[model samples]
Target: MEVTQANILETLPQDMIVEILSRVGQNSSDQLLILKSVCKSFLKLSEDPLVLKRLSLDRWRLSPWGNPKLIYLFNLCTVFGNPNAIFCLGLIGYFDTKYTDLGLDFLKRASNSQLKEAVYVYGVIIFASHQIEAKHVGLQILNETFPPVPELVVAVRIKVFDLMRQLWLFNRHPFDDVAMPCPISDHDGYFPQFHGFEIAIPECMSCFWAYELDVFANRFAYN
Candidate 1:
């Protein structure tokens, strides 16, 4: 009976293999982090930017309750050299808390991989986030960041934009948008508010259509 290494690998149980991968991800070396962090020429944020990165992080979302032991388990993909699992989860919109920035971080790390879907979704998030930012920092920069929401996500983005505008009008600062939370429900979902300054504008429809056109024009916009 001539056994080969291939046979041994094949014979290993799937769960066992997964466990091994999980361990590797948890114990990822400092060198690997540096190698990944520097992959993109300008991805690394300045030290101050790194502080901004952690400013609003919800640690519980990463590893809930008191069990921080699985923290690396969530980061296993990084250690195992596959960011797709993390990317796929982001697309499904599960990272509601810190999902947007977290996705971007993983993205900057895996810039070499074909991540069209992830990129598109990231655009959606960046648009919303930057829209909120525009309220305070100045519409010009936010305009550049959020721009037009992708067509498919247009309807939602318009609502986001309107709320953002309201936030800006009322709160009056970029960081204030984040500091203040809007009790936003779908204005378009029910009877339209035809009165008041917050009334839905036809321009929002423009934003929506822009997104649709963008999706169709580019064979791949942000699906």
Candidate 2:
């Protein structure tokens, strides 16, 4: 009897195989690729919509969009009803001024699913838009009523507060709209520099203090 990788994978429960693939997709993209190349069963599992959804969300959090792999997977998984993939696709559109309306439509679908990240980003996109109606609608999404699920309230509040804090920090920056370099053009660099200062400031301040202390000590020392 000839044995094969597919045969071994086929012996496991389908959901169990999917769970393993999902975890692999979440943790290591390289390993997932290797697995996918090993056998038909592994490849199929790797392409599972749920696994792809997790991979897309991780990529969205870690990397800039429009990567071919992300776009392909996102488009395919979206057809399978992956709300996160839909949200990410909408985000790509929202970030581009020309597609703002289209982006809003995708975001609206994801928001209806109560995907917290989608809701928060949708609000940001709308608020940043030039259209008056968009701004009003975005604000409403940001401040949407807490759901009746008691267990979700705390998490939802934290996400909202985090977004609000980021917005507050953004508004506090000294530059006006015209003077500011467009963040959208360099979203990866600029967004974190300005909005993520809560985390960055502490680390940066410590380094600054260390440098200052060294300079002062050197200046005071006698030759």
Candidate 3:
């Protein structure tokens, strides 16, 4: 009967309530949990597919061996097509378990969602497969992040490098044995001449991107 925040929220339309909840916990699952505990209405609406899809598990460490409750939460998010959840599950499945195909499928899904990190890693993985058609598709995927301009390419490289670093910090093993797209033999005779010195530039765009992937993969590779 008294005016309260819960009362006000309850009076709002369901779409409005869902929109508000979607923004409530964009970065922290803990916030969502607390939100769900606030009221019965909140609890029921918190699991709405729209809310779940936008929820971020950023504050949570992703691990198959992690807390079962958290894992369940991740599963819920994944079911609703949360890109980050799909990426996390893909990494765990691809690296920690024997379900590599399933993991790749999830990664592809995440990539299709335009999650930049997913796009970068999935492209690199596919490129490293060494099959000609896969390499072409992979290169096309990688090219989506990198524009033709040199400056833009550098910017994407740095952004992707930072993303890879964050992933390595949380999920190291999966990145450990990633195959390099460019072999050592291909590296020779590809360097361009610059200021009377040999530069690391490759002869082709494909190799150049391959070099970028190799550098990133090696930079994060476990010792």
lDDT of each model, Cα atoms only? 0.35, 0.54, 0.70
Pairs in steric clash, model 3: none
Q: Which candidate has the top score in TM-score?
A: 3
Using all chains and alpha carbons, the TM-scores for the candidates as numbered come to 0.27, 0.47, 0.71
- Determine which window of 10 residues in candidate 2 has minimal summed lDDT: 167-176
Per-residue error at 54 for model 1, in Å? 29
| Candidate 2 per-residue C-alpha lDDT over 98-160 given as tens digits, one digit per residue, 9 for 90 to 100 | 566786688888887768767755555455445556555655665573333323433653553
- Write one digit per residue (lDDT tens) for candidate 1, span 58-125: 11142222555444433443344444444433422223333445645664343234343333334433
lDDT of 3 by residue, 1-223 (tens): 6898878778878888788788887766778788888778888998888888989766666653457877776788888999988987776666556777898898999989887667866887777665678777888897786554444455545654543443434434444655544543555422334545334444566767666656656766542
Ranked by lDDT, the better of candidates 1 and 3 is 3
Clashing pairs in 2: none
TM-score of 2: 0.47
Best model per lDDT? 3
Off by over 4 Å in 2: 1-7, 26-28, 60-71, 113-116, 125-223
lDDT of 3 at 152: 46
Q: If ranked by TM-score, best first, what sequence of candidates would result?
A: 3, 2, 1
